[model samples]
Target chain A: MTQTNQPEINVQEKRPLDTGTAESTSSEPRFSPQVDIWENDRGLTVVADMPGVNADGLSIDLNDNVLTIHGRIEAQNPGKKVLTQEFEVGDYYRQFKLSEDIDKEAIAATIKDGVLAVSLPKMAPAQPRKITVVQA
Target chain B: MAFLPFFGRNFSGSFWELEKMRSHMDHVYNALADGFNQIRRNYTGVFPLVNISEDEDNLFLTAELPGLTADRLEISIKGETLTLKGAKTQDNAGDETLNYHRRERQAGSFSRSLTLPVKVKSEDVGAVFKNGILTVTLPKATEARAHQITVQAQ
Candidate 1:
């Protein structure tokens, strides 16, 4: 087994499956993770199920309303010699297109025990005013 | 509000039209099959996939997927719809296919599903895949998050 001297930057480019940006984006069969969303009066909260992933190997970034999450999970039996491998070992990839209503400046993320949580604050109306009407 | 579009719904206004408007949260859950032990829900324009006694508030979900990359996982949520889709490539181990005695690893494509409990922006979803495990972050709508309220006396 190999050990790292420092914490992983946890970026999308670190994945081995990132090549052929065209192949993954193409209409090819693939695997995806599960997600759960919750909304409040203030912002949005998202919970994603990512087993085998830890905090040091996770990353969260956004570009032009495109949120990207990338992480590396510890191999189940890295050093142990394997006779057979039923589970696939590769990078996880997914994409999402956001709307204009989200407050991009205040999105937060955390990974705990293989589960990732993200907080996205919603933008408020641009102007506020009180309406007054004269009684006729 | 009548003139406004239903977010995911296209001009056709058909239920299927929203398929193109999937968010990362929705994509992650939709990719999963029922597999005889799965529960999913869509509420407040969000998707939440839950099972019996699985309400740990911070439950964990790991899938058995091989021959895939981190960039392949698709997680998204549009309004209340969640979609998860990915494809496991064919195993290309050096000379392993020819000398294999028995093959039992499931291959090809995989998808998971889970409706949301609150509304979310598809662009805000986050996911990562590594060492055969894929992880994503599903953010709840600020209004749907658990919070404390104060009482005001008039």
Candidate 2:
């Protein structure tokens, strides 16, 4: 699996996603959510930090070899005057490319406390196998 | 030892001097790097970015803290200052044998204190944690609240 080129500065602060090439129709701004990806013998795991996003506001899709994750944040405070604003509220969007060795049908995702975890299991044939030798 | 002219008895002494100089430079470089890293961390700005809003009666403070539960957060108010403290634990990805492709999230303890514009009733403060967002409501003190005065026809 591989991800597109993302700048290193994105790790520090939330940045608005580039909408020049994307087909985003919503007027609400979208921010790229921070994620951590790791691979083990079983499969690959992706953990994302998406604060203010509930279970009903998250969506994950896989088309062809591209996997996309989108999260929406509902308006928390409405009609209240903002006194000191340090961060902006927006939705989250990110995408990743998957390899053929992964079992696309077996992918699963779970969310808790606004954090999302996606598990992509590897195909059986892609797993490493050990063979025992017998003396003839 | 006789192959080169500089490989005489002074070789060991000069070699020690060179080694000491190299070690000194190494220490200086490490210190400089540490200072840069410190500045970078701070330049990235504060953790759990907060937004404070207010109405006529109450002031609301909200912060985004993902992967944290209510028990991990502590909020306290003293005079006009409100303090928030919390620690975020790292997730367990089974074992250490896994190969990391990308890592961006951070886990550590954070403490932030902000002074409210107006004094609030400490005893009546309320806080709620939902969807990794923390919202604290502080009601304005009686004396600090705006009081509308009635005008009688003179």
Candidate 2's residue-wise lDDT over B42-138, tens digit each? Answer: 7655665678998899999988888889988889899999888777766664568889898888776777777899999999999999888899999
Q: Chain B, candidate 1: TM? A: 0.50
Clash pairs for candidate 2: none
Give every candidate's TM-score on chain A. 0.64, 0.78
lDDT of 2 at B144: 87
Residue lDDT tens for model 1, B35-116: 3223332221111121211121222233433334556656556676656565543333353223322233333444445555
Those runs of model 2 whose alpha carbons end farther than 4 Å from true positions after fitting are: A1-11, A20-27, A126-136, B1-45
* Residue-by-residue lDDT tens digits, candidate 1, A48-90: 5455566776777888888877655555433332322223444
Residue-level lDDT for B50 in candidate 1: 19
Model 2 TM-score is 0.76
Error of 2 at B124 (Å): 1.3
Find the 10 residues in a row with the least total lDDT in model 2 chain B: B1-10
Query: DockQ of every model listed?
Result: 0.02, 0.32
Could you give candidate 2's per-residue lDDT for residues A1-136 as a string of tens digits? 1112321222256778876786688877789988999998899999998988988999999999899999989876578899988788899999999988889999999988888999999988745779989999
